[model samples]
Structure formats: structure tokens, C-alpha cells
Target chain A: MEVMIMKRAIGVLDSGVGGLTVVKELMRQLPKEEIIYIGDTERCPYGPRPHDEIEAYTWELIEFLLSKNVKMIVIACNTATAVVLKEARKRLNIPVIGVIDPGARAAVKGTRNKHIGVIGTKMTIESNSYETALRHVAGEIDVYSLACPPFVPLVEAGELDGERVRAIVAETIRPLQSSEMDTLILGCTHYPLLAPVIQDVVGPDVHLISSGDETALEVAAILDFKELENDLDTVPAHQFYATGDVVIFDRLATEWLGQPVRAEKVEVSGVDA
Target chain B: MEVMIMKRAIGVLDSGVGGLTVVKELMRQLPKEEIIYIGDTERCPYGPRPHDEIEAYTWELIEFLLSKNVKMIVIACNTATAVVLKEARKRLNIPVIGVIDPGARAAVKGTRNKHIGVIGTKMTIESNSYETALRHVAGEIDVYSLACPPFVPLVEAGELDGERVRAIVAETIRPLQSSEMDTLILGCTHYPLLAPVIQDVVGPDVHLISSGDETALEVAAILDFKELENDLDTVPAHQFYATGDVVIFDRLATEWLGQPVRAEKVEVSGVDA
Candidate 1:
């Protein structure tokens, strides 16, 4: 077989620290690949914002990453991915990926009764992104969507596993338990950290799907198929950029990304299409 | 001693059917109080919406009841109360009660240590409404806030006492466990039904505050102060109204509110000053 060569980095962007979760999975699964991550913490929660703004903000981030010569891009924010993925895919020449399809596929495989519950950002739930994806995969499957807008802030605040968080989660996710869903998709990447709590709330019968893990697998598959798998000899270069607090991002990156990561602050001046 | 005039009706309103929990407490505590409840079920969550919108919606519900000649109004939705209580207090002719103060007061009194964990909807937490209320009652207390946006939807979906709801509860509220909070505030009225799950998740050390219970005490206090207390009656009149699914509102009201209440569907016009 001829030797395959890839020169560019893989771009991953999220509304905030949540995308770091997907980066962690990518690091574990695609060790040789150089990764560049941008967390838009400053204008986070693309969830409640207007669709046009979400689309514009997402493209601006993508363009920023593209300027760095990224070979592929990952839209990690559920809200962003829900509304902008199609436009982004068309606008970019390089491979574009989002967390929704992989998560839905995984849920389809994981579910015993074809009943699935999806919880995510307001935009994600409002758009029925996961429901559409799941239905596209298995037309007969039932999809229940609940918008868990507060989870992002709770995680951002660094209260991953606390009583206050638990009470909020228990109260927030209580409605999902009423459904007969055998699987729950952690529609937001930030949600995996909350997997244990979600698992507890959904019960043993319901399987929990991590969008990060599933999306990572999808990345691996795409790279393998395209023959673009990186085989760098030296230490892998991983750069993290945030439009918010670099200090907290550094702490969270170290916690989520496993390796020591120094995240630099990026100032996004204006919205670009 | 002067003879006191009993109030004709006690009005309770929530963004959705979750406020039935407060009505449940009210029914148990004040059996003779005629309850007129309105659940903005069509817009079940006032948490994630804009403050202005929440204020407008609350006033609309309050206005609807005012037209019905309600004596006292209970703002059962944490989000609405957080954003609009002050405005409601100023605008309404009758006594306007919010669940936050009562709930915060209950948390302060119940806690052994001053450390407290508060959980509510996004608006409730983001507004720092509960924290403010708690601090006002007890000064220099360490308060932790987490917004569980999915909670009300979860409870409404019927996952009250189960392993699934329990797991989600544990995960979401995990942060407060380490804070060594002696008391936890269920800042949203809907949160009371998840009390067992919340208690199990938080373990035995933390005492959980039910907004319903606190509001019940407040109702009693207000009634007593206003000299509107009524004698125990064999038959109580409890009327419920919903802007959305009357069937669902009635079902949850019967389950959570303790008494079988026939709720009517009403048009939710804008709230006038």
C-alpha cells in the first residue's frame, strides 16, 4: 500500500468548555492526530439565541479554525450543530462532522426497545435535531427530547458532582423517567461528565450514550476511510483556544483532556459569515 | 378581638403543572382555603425564557386570576417568581407571594451549619434569586446554586420515584455533596415531587427544602396576618386552569395536588399593569 500523508490539524469547536469533552475522546482514539480546539465561552449557550446568530457564530469559529489550515472540522456544540451543520458542510471543502449523527447511530444500536430520550441545549431540543437523526436511522423509533439548558453552566461553574447539582439534575431530568425510553443520548458533549447523574436518574434499564465517544468513533472511521490517519513521530501538538476564562479552561482541559494542556485566550472581534 | 374576613380564593400559578406540588402543600395545610390555580402549561418552562417574557407571562396569568376576583396570588414557578415577584408585588392589588423567600427561609431554619445548596430553573439560578433571598434571611451564609433546567420537564413526564430519575438527580446535584451543605433548597416548586430521589442522592447529611412546604407556611402566615384564616370545612373548592393540555394538567394536579380538581382551559392574554 502507498504511504498516506496528512499535513493539517483537526479542528474542534464548541460553544464553551463542553467541546473539550469531545477533544478528550479524540485524543484517546486518535493519538497521532494534531488537534486544535476553540471554545466560545464568551458567547456560549448558543441554545437560546436566534438560529441566524447561531449559524453566524458557528461559521466565524469554523473560519478561524480553517485559517489555521485544519484538514477536518468538528462542530461540537449541540445547539450550533443542530442549526449550522448543513451550511458549514456546504461552505467548507474539508471534511465536516457533527456530534448528532454519531450519537443517534450509537443510540440506535444501544437501545433495547427502540425508545430513546434526548436531553440537550434549548436549541438542540427545540430543533428536534436528535429526533430527526434517530428517525432517519430507524423510522419507527420513538424519540423524546428535553432541553437541559442549565447543565452547561453547572459544569462551567465546576460543580460536576455536588448536592446542589444533584438536586438540580434530579429535578430537571425527572420527566425523562416517565417515558419508556431504554436509551438516553447525552446530546451535549458537556453532558458526559453528568453521565453518572443521568444514569442514576434514567435508571439501570436505560443505556446512556456519550456523544463525545460516539463522535470520536465517527472521526476515527472517517479518517480511516479517507486514508488520512496521521502518524506523527514526535509528541502530538494539541492547542486549545477559548474566548472566555483561560484559567478555568486550563484547569478543565487538564481534567478533561488528561494531558497537561495550556489553553490560550482568543479574542473574537466580530461576527463573520 | 375583631372578627376577621376570610379570603374568597387563593390563586396559585406556575409555568406548568409542576406548581401543583405547592397546591398539594396548600391543600394539606389549609384545607378550607378555596384554591384557584392556573398553570401556563403551554409555556411549561419560564426558566430558560427571557426575564421580560417571564414577567409578561406571569402578569398575564395573574391578570387572568384577578379578573376572577382572587384574594391572594402565589407565584409557584421559581423562574417567574425570580424575575417578576417584585413587579407583581408592586402591580397587584392583593398580596403577591413568591415561593423563593419562603423556601429560602425554610432552608436557613433547617440547616445545622450555615452552608446551603440551592437548585432551581435557569432563571432562578442565573438571577441569583434564591441566593439573594437566602442571604437576606440569614447573612454571610455560603450558598451554592445549580440550575436543573430539565427537572420540571422530567418530573412532569412522570419519573418521580425511580432509578433513572435518581441517577440523573445524583449526577446533576453531585457538586453540593462536597460543599458540606447541611440544607439544600429545592428552589422551584415542581422540585418537591422529586424529594425522595433528591434525598437519596444527597444522602442523609443534607436536609432538602421543598418550595411547596415553605410556600405553605408562608400562605398560613399571610392568612394569619391578614386575618383571612378560615375554619376547617368539610368541602373545599379547588379550581384549576391551564393554557395548554387540560388533560395533562388535571392528571398531574390530581397526582401532585392530592385532591381531584377539575381544571378549565383558558386563553392566556397579555398581563396588563
Candidate 2:
């Protein structure tokens, strides 16, 4: 008799429900691959935390996924990716991808007027990762970045479409309207859910680049190149983990993924320095 | 002291100047990496040919690029990709990507109502590659395919805009007007150059997916994953080869790429069984 082993799953980590946007994309792009996602909702919004603390929490999430025998790691949160991507890539033997470079590359290619705008959390904007990556590809392009701290909170509260959310989005984007930017990068994973309002404000001329969609394309290509793709004929089940209330996490995942999702609450300990 | 050698260039092949669309994308996404493109203009319009003949001619182009030591291959022509992508991937050691999957994946994701349409050459539409690829991702989505043979000639003749091009586009796309497809795939590389007129005919509600842009994203990801990316500080030079008139090829390349191009005419013999 011959024995068969289950294929390893792709691991994804984020501070909260924001990374679900990326998960939705992965499911669409690579339907056969199994996924294991962790949301650190117990300490949600790693955006406002100190760099060292955010790094420690991200590592803890990585360790948990490693225990689950994940074949790859995707840092879907902008704050975590900007802070710990280099260190994670160095320490992990498997492939590690961050959302920043893919998004940056798309924005650079999508822009025609050499002017690009980026909107993200305070940590991501302050880090200036997008500017560095974009300038690295094209030396003379202009980059404009703004910090929208309230946008993430609005998304987590499930205020995606309404007058209040639209007003907030318009007010936050009012400053960039006259900047004459031909491309805009939604730096945070949570931002895609709010894309319609953002698109309405920016008008149709300015292209909106979503980090999740770009990242998913990168993931599919990497898997094919590395030969790590799941080729089994069996349909794989996806697993979701949260460090806080399972009910809330399940509700958000179900709504965003357009399917019934059950998330389990797991306590993750901090990693040592 | 250790001396570093230059990295191999990315190889791109097309039946004619149509593949410049893909080259334009690669330059934007991977600016540091060198590229070597081959356009078999002496045997242009492979759409109406038999599958076996198209495969043989495509291999001859591949052999020429292999002699140049390319790190990867991109089948930029829709008819060739539909017939030879699998065998090419099997025979080549490096990664091989086709335009069909990327365009199909984008169309699947871009559609909100689960209805999509594909436009390509007669051979490509008859191959049913897009329908198979799209259904592999989503089981119940609707796919409509149409063959527009006259579109390519208009592009090669530099009739990209004006009332004449718009009228031709409207007439060619009239068959799919009642299909209720929310997303349309420009399955052929030449179609993107005519996007303005196509968009005008399709109206504002329908989204257009460009295979060149999507394939470039996949190429960048694979290069990063395989660690085959050129990290040198030297400026990369691109090389162009044609099997037909160098003057005509040079004119089209320079006009489309917005840069001065010098094409070398080379004779490529068909492969024998």
C-alpha cells in the first residue's frame, strides 16, 4: 500500500481583519492551495505601536504558522511588512513575501505622469517604504504620501458604504485632489474594501492600485517558479486563527470572503528579543 | 578578487510587432533586468495557420532566444500560447509563462456578475483556452469568446484613433453587445494598442483586461522567487531581432516604446521533425 501526505498550507499574518482582503485574493487566484491565516486581534492595529513591539508580535504569529507546517509566509499588514520583512526573509528558510514591493512596482508602472500618491497608516507613511521602493525602480519619479489613521478604524467597524464613510474618505482625500497624481496606492490591506468611495473621489483618470491584488499575483507566480504549488486533486480546507473574540473574527471573515467562515481563538505568546 | 558576470536577459517572442506591448510592460516592471525580443515578421499572422506549424515556428524563435541565454521565457502571442505553453514549460528548464492564463485570471477577478468575454484571433478563440482556464477557477461563470480578424491589421497600419478606427471597432464588437459581459479580455497582444477605441465601443461599464500588464506582474514575481533577478549596478541594454524588414520593425518599435530602436534582421529556419 502507498501512503499519501497532505500538502503544506500557505501562511498569512496580519494585525486584524484587514488581511482578509489579501486572503480573498489568494482564494481567487490559487483555489487549490490550502491557507492558514492568523489575525492578532488581541493586540489589533499594530500600526500605532512601536517598531520593536510590532516586530515581536509579527514573529510570534510567524512561529505559530511554522508550527502548522506552512510552506510560505505572506506579511499582509503594511505596518508589519514595513518593519519586519527584511528580518523575516533572512531568518526563514522558506519563501517570504511582503505586500509593499508588489504594490510599489504596480504603482510605478501604472503611472503615466511620473506623479504617484500613497495613502496608508501613520506607521506606513512615516516609514517611507513606498518612496524608497518606487525610487529604486525609477530614479526620477515624484512620490506623495499621506497618513490616514482613521481609515482603518472605519473599515474594522464595518462602515464600508454609507454617507458617514463616504464623507470621511472624501475629507481625507481632499488634499490630494489638486496634486495632479495619475496613480494612487492603497497601502493598507484594509483599504480595498473602501475602494469604491476612494475611486469616486479620485475620479476615473487616476488609477487605484490595490496591494492585495498585486500581492496575490506575485504569490501565484512564486509558487509556480519554486514548484511549491499544491497539485493534489483533493479540495483543501482553509484554516483561520484569531487571538481575540472568535465570533467577531468569524463575522468579518464571512462577510468579506462571501462565504461561511469559522475562526478559532488562540492565545499567542510574545517572542523573545 | 572575484569578478561578477552579467545576468541573463528575459526572452520574449511574438509573430510580429504586436509583442512590443509585453516588452513595454517588462521594461516598466523590471527596469534593471535586460530583455531580448524576437518578432518573426517574415511569417506574421500565425492565427490562421495549423497548430503543428505554429508550434514548429514558435520553437525556432525559442531556439534563437535560447542561444542568447535568456533566464526566462514569455509567450507573448495568444495563438502560440494556446498551442505550445505546456510543451514549452515541459521542455525548458527555466520558467515559462503564457498570456492566456494571466488574462483569464484577471477577467475572472474583475467580473462582478460572473460573466466575462474574450476577444482574440480565430485560432485562439477556437482553442477554447480561456474558457477552460476561467472555469478551472470558477465553476459556474459564463464565458463568451469572439474572433476579430480585422483588428490586428488596423493596428499594424497605425490606425489607432479617429472615426475610422472607432467605427471598425464598434462594428467588430457588435456581436458581444448583448452578451451582458461585465469584463472583456484583450486576449491578443495587438488589441491593447487599440484600447481607446475598444473602450469607447464597449461603453464605460465594461472593464478591459490587458494580458501584457498582467503577464509582466507574473514575470516579476517569478524572477524574485527564483533568485534570478539582475542585481548589478550596470545599466541594462535591450536587444531586438526581426526576421523581416528592419526598417518597418524599427519604426513600430520606436513609436510604441517611445525610444529609439535599431532592429537587426535575422533568418530563422523552421524546425524539422
Candidate 3:
């Protein structure tokens, strides 16, 4: 039984390289556990898509992970988590965790003045997931949410730290300056890469909460609680699969995770059911 | 199915009233979910007991909660979490969460200089659970642990603030002033009540991580993941049980939770199996 639990890898899914942020955290926290990551880069940027389409794509990704017999599943993309987390949890018996609640909990806990801000894709902000979650944890707190669609693109383009990116971030967050939110939730997994620029724009007094780090912690606790942790002495190799250009995916994965990664392109067509 | 999910209460167990901190957090975060708390006050201060005795006492509490058809369980005491979390998860089918990992994760994330401190009873510090958990999440960091046995007793006595308590706190934490730990884990749930004095002694530069709050977040996340969340609109009355003096338990529970509590006494003699 112990060997079976140790052998089963954790499944992580994301819309694109954005999920790599969560994967990076999981790798750092659970070094002994094997990870199988799948990035739906072909349908990358699930933010702009309709809810039905996003749900379908997320289901396809989940199906692929289920095929690999993962002991647990992590929805690394905020957009996917917003749309499909409830339904997925209902259907699957294994543990399934998303990024929103963890981030919301941290933001609520860190905030002293009962005021918080959230920045994410348009769909995530529109869904009101963070605001709802924050209110669920902390009743009647002021939640100000903004849709920063351009942030993900800049992060994907590797424009993390420069004058132009900083200016864009500053201009985007200018409206929140007067809101006086002491804590801000980085609602998207991709936002952590742009943390320095965001921090500079938001000023030093505001705390930035990362969803990936919080999600990684939740995953670790769940792993221990479920007794699925890998106790083997041998080092485990991580596996990555993408439904888009393999070379680009491999490059981004390596860059974001700070390690050499060989991302393979696989066809996940007809998995939308 | 939804009705059944909504009706099942969350089971929380502790060595004594210290677990009320966790219960307080659960009431704050998951207001709609029903809670069934059992305090093994008859075997209070499990911290000084043998590991086997502690494990047996913890299982008795778990069995009592399981008899209530609880949807989940939270080990609110650090010493109990250190000794029984692994075995309980292996033996039970429902989700089981402990306080240590969540507190460890938050401390690791909150710290900037890779230096952290932990304060708990002798057993918790001796168990090395927090150190192991912190290392599991953030590799190669400096961990300084101190056993603050007197703190819990002071809290149990309701001596949260005043010059006398402050003096005790200052003297107790004087050793860590030079350690320069940016984050400190209130490893014991009872410590949060003394947070003000601890913060004053540790200085404003250090962040205090509460296991109760963090564990509450983990419980909320697990509830959503397991599809066991109570989404009903009606308010749920919380149930409390104790194995010691019912009047004292009720008084402490009412004082700490800032609400009226009806505590019932029950005998758990020969429950150690």
C-alpha cells in the first residue's frame, strides 16, 4: 500500500506556462513526490474564452491527468479554477485543489484594515470568485477587483522587469493607489513573475499574496493528510506535457522553473466530454 | 446529496480548551458549516504524556467524533497533530487536517531572511514536527525552537495581558531577540490569545503565524475540494463536548469564543484502544 501511494504522481493542469509557477512551488515543497504537469497551450489563455469552452478544455486536461493515475489534482490556472473546480470536485474521488481559496484566505488573513484588492484576468474578476471567497472567510470586507488582461501577456513575453512593463503596470494600477488596500491578491498564477514591477507600482506598504505559494502549501497538507506522500530515498524526475509548440513550451518551462525541462507535445483532442 | 452534504458537521478534537482557538477560526471562516468539537479535558495537557498514551487519547476523541457521522476532522492541538495525524489519515476515509503544516507553510512564505522561530509545548518542540515541516517546504533555512510551557498555562488562566504577563513573555523570548527571526510560528493553538504580549516582546518586525487561522483555511479548502461544504442559508448551532469539568469548559469556551456555549460532560474511560 505504501509503495502504491508513493508511486502515484501528482497531476497539475494549467492553461499555459502560467501554471508553471504553481509547478515550481510544488517541486520546491514536495521534492520527493513525482509530478505530471499538462499545459493546454493550444487553447492557451483561457481567460478570453466563454465559460462553456473553458470548462470543456479544463475537463480535457483533467481527463489526461486522471489517465496518469495521479493521487491528487491541482488546477493551476485561475480561469479554469473559477469555472470547473466545483464540478470536477463533484465528479472525482481523489483530492482536487484550486488556487483561488488559498490566495483569498492568505489575503484575508494578512489584511488588517479589512480592505483588499485583487488583480486577475477579466473572466476571473467578472466571476467574483475572489471577492466571494474573501467574504466567505471574512464577512463583509471591502474587496476591490481589477481585470489586468495585459499582465499575463507581458509575463509570457518575458517582459518582467523593464521601464515599459513598469510603466504599464503603474498605469494599470494607478486607480488602486487611492483605494488604500493594504493587501492585494495576485489572483493569477502568472502574476508572480511580474511581482517586482507590481510591487514597485503598488508601493512598499501593500502586501502581495501569491496564489501558487498558498496552493502549494495546501497541496502539501493534503498530501500528508491523505498519506500519499512519497517517502522513497531516490530522487524523482518530473514530467511535462503541452498541447502546443514543444520547443517554446520547453523553453518557458525551463526558464520559469529554474531547471532544465523537456516538455513533450501531445494531442489531447476529443477529450472535451 | 447536497442536503446530506450540508447537514454533516465538521469534527474537531483537542486536548482541551486550547482547541477553542481553532474552533473560533472555523466559526469565522466557515460560518455556515456546523461544527462538533470534543475537548479531552480529562486527559488535558497531552503535551507531557507518552506518545502511546497521547495517540490512544486522540483516537478516543476521533472515535467519538466519527460516531457523530462528521464529514471531516481537524486535529486542533499541535502535540496531537504531531503524534496522530499520520495514523488517523491512514485509518479514516474522510478528510483529516492538522494545524502544523498550515502554520509552517505560512511562516515559510512570510519570512524573507530564511530565519524562523517556533514556540510550543515541550512535546511539540521535541517532536520536531514544525522544523521538519518548514524544511519540507523551504529547504535549508535556520530554525530556532523554544518550548514555552508556561505560556499555555497563563492563557488557560486568562492572563492574556498586563505587566505581569508581559514580563513573563519578555523574559521567555529574550533569548530569541538576538536570533533575528522575521517570522515566528505560534505552534500551539493557545498562543494566539497571548499574541499581543508576544508581539510586544518579539517586536513589531516579526510576524506571528497562527496555526488556528491557517488550519481554518485548510479546512475550508478541503471542504470545497471534498464537495462537503454546507451551502445552506440557515445558521447552524455548534455542539461542544468535554471530558472534564463542564462548568469550567463552558466558561472558557464562552469567554474565548465570545459567545454562549453549552458544554456537556462525558466519560471516556477505557476509550484507549
Among residues 3 or more apart in sequence or in different chains, the pairs in candidate 2 whose N, CA or C atoms overlap within 3 Å are: none
Residue-by-residue lDDT tens digits, candidate 3, A106-176: 78767778799999988899999999988766676899899997898898889999899999999898878
CA lDDT, every prediction? 0.77, 0.87, 0.88
Tens-digit lDDT track of model 3 for B1-273: 768766999999999999999999888777788999999998788988888899889999999999999999999999899999988888899989999998997787677788999999888999899999887656667999998878988998999999999999998887888897999999999999999999988989999999998899788877866668887667888999999999999999999999999998879875332
True-vs-predicted CA distance for residue A205, candidate 1, Å: 1.9
Off by over 4 Å in 3: A66-69, A90-93, A111-114, A132-141, A177-182, A203-205, A267-273, B51-53, B108-114, B132-142, B177-180, B267-273
Specify the poorest-scoring 10-residue window by lDDT in model 2 chain B: B1-10
Instruction: Give the C-alpha miss distance for residue A92 in model 3, angstroms.
Output: 4.2
Point to the candidate with the largest DockQ. Answer: 2
Candidate 2 chain A: worst 10 consecutive residues by lDDT? A1-10
TM agreement with the true structure for every prediction: 0.49, 0.90, 0.88
* Deviation of model 3 at B208, angstroms: 2.6
- Candidate 3 chain B worst ten-residue window by lDDT: B264-273
Candidate 3, residue B240: CA error in Å?
A: 2.9
Docking class of 1: incorrect
Tens digit per residue, CA lDDT, model 2, B11-102: 99999999999999988777888899999998888887877889899999999999998889999998889888889988899888889888
**For residues A26-85, what per-residue lDDT tens digits would candidate 1 score against the true structure?**
865565678999999888767777778887788889989988988889998888888887
Tens digits of per-residue lDDT for model 1, B83-193: 787777776667888887767655655566778999987767888988876654345589988988768778878888777887788888877778979889988777888
Over all chains combined, what TM-score does candidate 2 have?
A: 0.90
